[model samples]
Target: MTIPEPGGPDALLWSEVPDPVPGPGEVVVDVRATAVNRADLLQRQGHYPPPPGAPAYPGLECSGMIGAIGPGVAGWEVGQEVCALLAGGGYAERVAVPAGQLLPVPAGVDLVDAAALPEVACTVWSNVVRLARLAEGETLLVHGGGSGIGTFAVQLGVALGATVVVTARAAKHERLRELGAAHTIDYREQDFLEEVRRVTDGRGADVVLDIMGASYLSRNVAALAADGRLVVIGMQGGRKGELDLGELLAKRGTLAATALRSRPTGQKAEIVRGVQEQVWPLVEAGRVRPVVDRRLPITEAAQAHRLVESSDHLGKVLLTLG
Candidate 1:
């Protein structure tokens, strides 16, 4: 897919593009599937662009078979089934991926569905587990529980022995609970901060994985437990908001914001390695699995984007190729 001009979902033009050649330490993947992400939507709207040296197209993760390998890349051979975390270029039939970012498909996942795992696994494991250090017995509050990141975070938190609480639409509450959410607050009808307090008996969440940035900033701070950590990964609600440092100080809370696509290749590789080592095992063991709402052909990416933008899907909406 190529975007001649950035605009709405229709801006994605699935036209011919030159084949990608693998550079040193990279491999070319004949993409089988790719997953739609909020970042893709942002890029489509011209609000976010790929980092330097990345493909102009938008896709953050893909699953496929290795079609070629570049010099200085070893331990991976052509024709191996794998998935990758991409900075961009996953919207096409093929993509060149840094060797370090490739991961073998988890033992039980379908090749197409495997595309759903890389981005969400890396994001949640990196921020929620590695950075925030959400320990066993802690309470984790996940905003946007029906999203790819939200669904993955909910499951990962549960797998790590935390009590997971999520704020999502009432329609998604049942599914979120089935995915291991201990409490589900309907964001449209309930005040999450109040609900968090009620559910935790006023202790609040020990860790919060937030996506609604500025709009939720104050309430997120107020919902934090003493010594809490809040990791903000998206700005769907807005980017500028006032933070009550006094309230954060009184709670002894910590706040961190991160973006995955802009990270250096080496850092991304490390996160990929972390996911393979820690999260892949959980997946193979069936403790954690990819949650896909539906799959659409690559050519219908505009429809997929419409579905995601509408917030009607429960999990990831995948784009597939032959």
Candidate 2:
């Protein structure tokens, strides 16, 4: 992760940097695995920079065993297997993270697979369930149904009693349907807006989770029903575009964007706490678990980035400490 400033996949290299040690209110984890995110790729490409006071390393989430605790850190013990949200430093042999951001690995899943949960789950919870306020019996439209966030959104939306329609390419439709997407739109072959209209009986969607930013702005506003909400997380296509201001006002719609990696430590810890209270028990009881597509050694980071960037994998591609 220290290969070069604004590094690319080819630039991602393993270096023998000094192992992390805990600072006050922090704990150092002996990392078992770390998950790849688009943000990491951006950072490597010199497009994204870690927020102020964040670690210089490049990983947003990781699972590992506890190694040491610093002063004032309590309620966690050495050797505990956990997954944590990090501002950075996840792509290392040992990562020092704030104790409050850590969550215990669920009863049945391996520590490695658990690495996939924290980031996506936190994102979904903050957006779909929290900001958008999706309710049972509502219609939820999810763009990018094949992605880690999309898959999680599909299952969680359906399980919450909302009708879920997803936009994915044809090849991934069947699996997406199996994962609780009530309707699927092959975005390559069909128009997402047209499909959402058809699936919602022309009422449009009650909630739309969009990862395509400006590209979908005007169309997303058009696809929403009265009092609907549109949550934008990533703009894969482009960042600037026109919005249908008339449509937004006419439909009484809501628009919001959030990023997890760049949040303040207190805010991030609060999200973690909320997840533990509301989502962790469900995971513990087998209601849902992190979905993993593949795991590779940290030295093979470049290959993992290629897999994720290819958009072929269904869930998450993780990098383990070599």
Candidate 3:
């Protein structure tokens, strides 16, 4: 898919584009599926652009078979089933991916559904586990529990032995609990900060994985347990919010915000390796699995975007190729 001009979902044009050649340390994938992400929506609206040297198209992850391999890339062969975390260019029939970013499809995950794993797995693993060091017996608060990232974080936190609490719509509460959320707060009807306090008996969350950004900044800090860590990964709720440093200091809380697409290739490769080593086994063992709301043909990319924008989907909405 090519975007001649950035606008709405309709801006995505499934027009012809030149085939991508595999560069050194890269492999070309015959893309079978790609998952829609909030980053794709932001790029579609012209608010976010791919990093330098990335494809102009908008997709962050894809699953496929290796079609070609570039020089200096080893241990991977053509025709191997694989999925990749992409900086861009996944919204097409084929994409060239750095070899280090490719992962074998888990023993039981469907090829198409595997597309949902790379991005969410890498993001949650890197932010929550690697950076924040969410330990066993801690309390994890995940905002936007119905989102791809949100759902994955909830499950991963549970798998790591943490008490998972999420803020989502009432409609998604039951499903989230089924996914291992210990408590679910209906953000529309309940104040998450208050709920977190009540659920933890006023101790608050030990680690908060937030997506709402600036809008939740103050409350997120206030909801932190002593020595808590807040990792902000998105800005859906405005980009600017005032923080009460005094409160944060009193709580001895730490705040960190991160983005995946803009990370250097080496850093991304490291994250990919971490996911493969630490997370892939959980997936293969069925402790964690991809949650997909629905799959649509690539031609219905616009519809998929609209579905995601509407926040009606429970998990990821995937776009598939023939």
Candidate 4:
């Protein structure tokens, strides 16, 4: 897949490209499927660019079979089924992936569906579990609860014994609740702050997994418990906002933001290892599952992008290779 120029969904083109060859410590994958992510949309529109050393394509995660291994690589063989977290290039039929980023498809998960797991699983684990340190009996607030990341965070938070509160449109509330949200706030119909307060008995959320970014900064701070942590992972709502440092200081709250795509190879490897060890078991056991709204052929890349941008889907919209 190629983007001739940054613009709308039609900018995505399925054109022939040179195959990726693995370098040392890397592996080449014959991609079976790739899931669309918000980051891909940003890249397609020229608002975001792939990090240096990543491919020029738009995809961030894929599932496939190992096609080749580079020199100095070990413990993985050609023809092994795997899903991988990628910085870019997943939109293609073949992509070069860092060896450390490859994850075996969990038992009971179809190979194609596994493509949805890597990005969301790693992101939720790294930020919500590792950074936020959400504990049993605590409260978690997840914004955009109908999205791929939102759905994953909801299940994972619930599985870990935290009371999960989610913000989504009214139509998605029932499904989100079935996915383990303890409470669902219709972000369009109600004030999340008031609902959060009502649900928590005035205490506030212990941790907030935010995607709206600056637009929600103040309210997210207000929603925090004393000693709370706010993890901002996306900026869909805009990048700049005013924050009241005094209020944050008084609450003893911490604000941290992260983007997985730009991390160093080693750091990404660490997160991938952590996800394999800590999160995969839950997936294999069926405590969490991929929420795929629809699957489209890779050639329908533009349609897939439009689906994601519309935000009408309940979960991930996947693009599968022939």
RMSD (CA, Å), each prediction: 0.6, 1.2, 0.6, 0.6
- Ranked by lDDT from best down, the candidates are 3, 1, 4, 2
Task: State the lDDT of candidate 4 residue by residue for 124-243, as single tens digits.
Answer: 999999999999999999999999999999999988999999999899999999999999999998999999999999999999999999999999999999999999999989999999
Model 1 lDDT-worst window of ten = 1-10
| lDDT per residue (tens digit) for residues 48-85 in model 2 | 88888777768999999999999999999999999999
- For model 2, the superposed segments whose C-alpha errors exceed 4 Å read none
Number of the candidate with higher lDDT, 2 or 3: 3
Off by over 4 Å in 3: none
TM, every model: 0.99, 0.97, 0.99, 0.99
TM-score of candidate 4 on Cα atoms, chains taken together? 0.99
Local accuracy of candidate 1 as per-residue lDDT tens digits, 146-255: 99999999999999999999999999999999999999999999889999999999999999999999999999999999999999999989999999999999999999
For model 4, the superposed segments whose C-alpha errors exceed 4 Å read none
Where does the lowest 10-residue lDDT sum fall in candidate 4? 13-22
Report the number of clashing residue pairs per model.
0, 3, 0, 0
Q: After superposition, how far is residue 135 of candidate 4 from its true place, in Å?
A: 0.8
lDDT of 3: 0.96
